[model samples]
Target: MSKERSSRILHGFISACLVAAVAAFIILAIPDHLGRAGIGAGSATKKNFPSAKNLSSIVDLEKEKQAAEVKIENPSGQLAYFKPEQVPIPPGQDAQAQDLTLTDPNQSPDVAGGSGAAVDDSSFGNAVPIEPEPTETFQGVPDNFVPVAEDTPRGSSITLVTYPRSSLAIHEPPAHVLRRSKKEYSWIFTPPELEKDVAFWKAIYSRYDKNQVVLHHPIYLDIIYDVVDLGYIEGDMRLSELEKQHKKEKLIEEKRERIVSILEMLAQNQRLSSSLNDEEWRIKKLFDNVGDPKKFQRAAEEFGVRAQIGQRDKFIAGLKYSGRYLGEIERIYEESGMPRELSRLIFVESMFNLKAKSSVGASGIWQFMPQTGKLYLRMNKIVDERNDPIAATHASIKLLRHNYNELGTWPLAINAYNAGRGRLKQAVQTLGTKDIAKIVKNFKHRAYGFASRNFFPEYLAALEVAENPEKYFGPISYDDPLRFEMVRTAYHISLPSVAGVSGIPLEELLELNPGFSSKVISGDQLIPIAYPIKVPEGKGSIFIAAAARAPKSQRGSIRHVVAPNETVNSIAWMYGIDPTRIRQANANIRRNPSKGEIIVIPFD
Candidate 1:
C-alpha cells in the first residue's frame, strides 16, 4: 500500500477506538449519576398528587408508597434533587425545603379529598435530624513544623532605627572592652568557648553537684575566709548561730557537723585562754588546734579554700538590690523566650551591680563586652545604655534569644553568650552534637578553656543560691526598684542645671541616669538633642519647665578645673552626670579624674 493510504487507515483506526472508549464510559456512568438525581432506568415515577376531580382514582396509592419506601431504604440518595411538583414533599412543607430543613407547619386532615396514600406532614419528623458535622477541627500548623524558607520570599529588607543623630547628638567612643571591675576572677573569666574535643565535663559537673558547695575568690575581691577546726574535721570558716538555723538540709548536714565541731573547739579554747584578746585567742587557738595556721592560710591564699565572708556578705547585699530590679529582669527574659531563672546569671556576672565593669571591658549587670554591647545598647562617649538596667536587660534579652536560636539548647546558648556563638557552632558541628555535658566532656579546642566549660554550671549554681538566699544567708532586705520618668531635652543642658530645674538633688538625678556618659554631663559635650534625662517620678513637668527657665549660659558646655578630693564619680555626681563621659572627655585619665586636672563638662 502507498504511504498516504497507510496513514489514513491508522487515523481511522485510532478514531474508532476513541469513540468506543467514550461510549463505554457513558454506559457505565449514566445509571449512577441518574440514580442520584432520582431519575434512573426501570425506576417508574409514582403520582404524588391527586387530580382535583376524582382524586382517589387519579393517584395510585400503592405505587406512591413503594417509591417513598425506596427513598427511605437508600438514605444516602440525593432526595433533594426531586422537584416538589414531580415528587411528594410531605404536606405542609415548603417546595424549596432542603433535605435537612424539615418542618410541619400545618396539620391537614390526611389530605381529606385525596386517596388513603396521602402524605402525612408528621411522618417526615420520624426521620433523624441531620446536623452538618463540624468542619474538621483546624489546629493551626506550628511555625517550625513546615519549611518556612520555601514559602518566604527571598531578599526582604527590614529597617531598624538606632539613635537619631538629628534628634540626639551622640558621641560614641571607639568600641573596645572596658574593664571596670574591682577584683580579678582568674578562673571564671579565663576560659574560652566550648570546643568539640575538650573534655572538661568533670570540672563543669563539679559546679552543678548539689551536695558539693564550692567557694572561690570573687571577681571583685581577693580575700578568703579564715579557717577553723572542729573535733572531727576542720572547716574553712565558722558558722554563726543564725547560720546554723538555715543549715538543716541533708546535703548540708556534713558541713554543718564540721562547723559545729569547730565552734565547740573555739568555745573550749576561749574558756582556757587567759592572755589573748577574744579575737586574738580565737585566731591563735584555731591556728594552734587545726593543723598549722600558716599552712592553712597559705593554702587558702593559693587555692581560695573557702568562700570569703566579706564577698558573700556583699552578695547578700547585692540580693537586696536585685529585689529592686528582679521583676524587670524576669519580664525581659520571659518576653525574649528565655527561662526566667536565667536572670540569676546577672548575679554570677556582676552580683546585680549596675556599675560593675571588668578589666576585659565587659560592663553592666549583664557583663556585655563593648563590641557586643554596642549591638543592642548605645555605647558612646555621652551614653552607655548598658548602665541603664532596663536598657541593658533589653539588650541582653535580644542577645540571649539570638544565642538560643543558634545553639538550640539553653545551656549551650548560655555558654555561647560568654564564649561566642561562632565557636560554639563550630564545636557543635565538629562534634555532631549539641549536648552540653557531652560537649564539655569531649570537646577540645585551643580556645575552649576552664571559663567557657564552667559558664553554664556557674549559672546553675548562681541560680540555685539566688533562689534560696535565705537558706544560704540570713534574712535579706531588698532594695525598692528605682522609679523615674524620662524627660526630653530641647537643647544642650548641663546636668547640674537639670538638677536645679527638677528640684531634685544632683546626686539623685545622676544616680537615676547612670547611662549618660560623664562627658555629656560635665560641659565637655552637650547633652545631645532630645536626650531623655530620667528624673524622679512626678518631676518631669517641673524639670522641663525649670530647664526652659534656666539661663542659656548655664545650659551650655563648661570647662571645669578639678580640685582636691574631686574623683570622677564625685565630680560627675556634682554635675548630675556620668563619670564615664568625664573619663572619655579627658583621655589621659584612665579611671578617675585626678586633682587639678582640666575637664570639659557637657551641658544637656
Candidate 2:
C-alpha cells in the first residue's frame, strides 16, 4: 500500500510537470517580438500566414505546433525545430522573419528565424494576442563535478585580447640575452646613383659574418621602401646616450677625412703652397730641408727626365744661342780681369736658370741685395736690369772686376761675388784684428743674413764641381750651353706676330723670354729670340735691317726715345746696335740720349 501511494505521488508530479510544459509551449508558440531577429522583437514568417486550406484542428497534437515542422512517419517530421536561440544558422542560410527580431541592428544575416503557424493580426476575429517566449537560460556546469587544473607551457603567461574577437595571447618570458641598452638603431637607404661608392659596401658585405649580420641583400640595391615602412610602425628609433656619443664621433671622423682628402688633392695638384715642407709629398728628406744646390739637385733627379733628360733638347740648343752676342762667358771673364772659372757661378746661382729671384729682391744668377744692387748696379721702378740675364751678368762681371782689382786673389774675388766689396773690406779690417780662416770658418756667425752665410761656399762648390765633378763627386755633364740672344721687334709687336715672323714657335718664344710676362716691357726692352747654331756671324747690321721688315702697323711711328740714366751706347746695345755705329750715331752716345732722337733704320 505504501508503494502504491509513492507511485501515485510520482504520477501526480509527472502530470503536473506535463501541464506546466504544455502551458509554456503554448506561450512559446505565440508571436513574441514585433521585428525579425529572434530576440525581444517579433518578425514575419510563413507560420504567421499559413495556407487556410491546410488548416487543421488544434486537437491534432502534431498540427498544433509552430512553423518549420515538416510531415514525416512516426511523429510527423523532425527533431525539435531548433529553437530560434539554438538555430545553427545552416552555415549559408539566412534567418526568416519569424526566426528573428527587427528592432535590433548588427544582427548576423545567417541567423534563422521562428514563429507560430497561421496567426492573423486582428483585434476581434480569430487573432490570438501572443506574448513573446522568454529566452531559454543557459545552464552552467554542475557544482558536484570536480574541476581539474589546466595545462600551460613552462614560460608562457596569458593575456586576454580585449578586441571584438577576444582571444588568448601569450607573453613569452625574456630571451636568453637580455638587452641592457635602451638604444635603438635605424638604417638609411641611399639611391644607387646618389651614392658615390667604390663598391665598399659590396666588399664589406662579402666578408661579413652571416650569423652576425642582419641585412643581407646580395648585389647592390636600394632598400628605400623598406626603411620608409619601418617609420610608421616604430616612429623614430630612440638612441641611448652612448649611441649618440658614438654617432658624434663618427661624424667628426668623416668630416676630418673629407677635410684631409680635400687638402691632399690640393697639395698634390701643386695648387697649394708647400714651399716650406716637401716631405708631405713623400719626397726625400734631403730635398725637404733645402738651402743649397745638392738638395735641389736631388729634387731635379726625382723630377727626373722632365727636368734634366727631357730638357736635353733645350740644353743642347743652349750652345747655339749666337747673335753677334757674347755667349762666351769664359772668354768674357778672362777679359774682365777675373778668373775664367767664375763664369761657372752662373750654373750654381741658377741652373744657368736665366730667371731666378730672391726674397729680398735679388734676381738673375748672382743674387744681389736691393740696396747693394743700387750702389753698383742700376735699377728703376719702370726698369729692373736685375731681371735681365745678360745685362745683370754684365753688371756682375763689372762688380767682379772691381773686387778682383782689390783682393788680388781668385778665391777672394769669388768670395767677394757673395760677400760684397764693402763687406769684404770690413772683413779684411776685422781680419787685421783676427785670423781670416777663423773668422770665415764657422758660417753660423756670418753677417748679411742667409745670403752671406752660404754665398762663398755655393760659388766655390760650383767652381770645383764644374772643373772636377768626376774627382769630387762623380762625372757630370755641363748643360749644352746658354742658347739665346735678343732681337728687337717693332713697338707693340705681339709675341704671336714675332712667332709668325721668326718661324719660332710661340711657346719657344715665351720660354726664351721668361722675363716678359706680357709682350710689353721697358721702352728699350730687347725682345728675346733664339737662333740656330748657324747665323751670319757678323751680320748685326743685316739682322737689324731684317728686324725692320715687320709691318708698319706693328711698328711705332717714332724711332727711339731714350730715358734718364741711359747712355746712347746702352740704348744702341739694347736695340742690338753696332758699337762703331753707336759711336757714329752719337759721338757722345756714352752720355744719355737726348729726350727725342729719331734714329732711322731699315724697315720693310
lDDT of 1 by residue, 504-582 (tens): 6777787877777776556444453334466665444445444443333123345565555445554453344456666
Which candidate number maximizes TM-score?
Answer: 1
Compare the candidates by lDDT and give the number of the best one: 1
Over 4 Å off, model 2? 1-327, 335-337, 369-391, 433-435, 442-446, 471-478, 482-495, 510-604
TM-score for predicted model 2 compared with the true structure: 0.35
TM match of model 1 to true structure: 0.44
Report lDDT (CA) for all predictions. Answer: 0.49, 0.35
Over 4 Å off, model 1: 1-310, 501-503, 553-604
Mind giving the per-residue lDDT tens digits that candidate 2 earns over 299-374?
2233221100112222222212311122344434444555444665665455455567766666765565565554
Alpha-carbon RMSD to native, per candidate: 35.4, 51.8
What's model 1's lDDT at 391?
71
Alpha carbon RMSD to native, model 1: 35.4
lDDT (Cα, 0-100) at 327 in candidate 2: 33
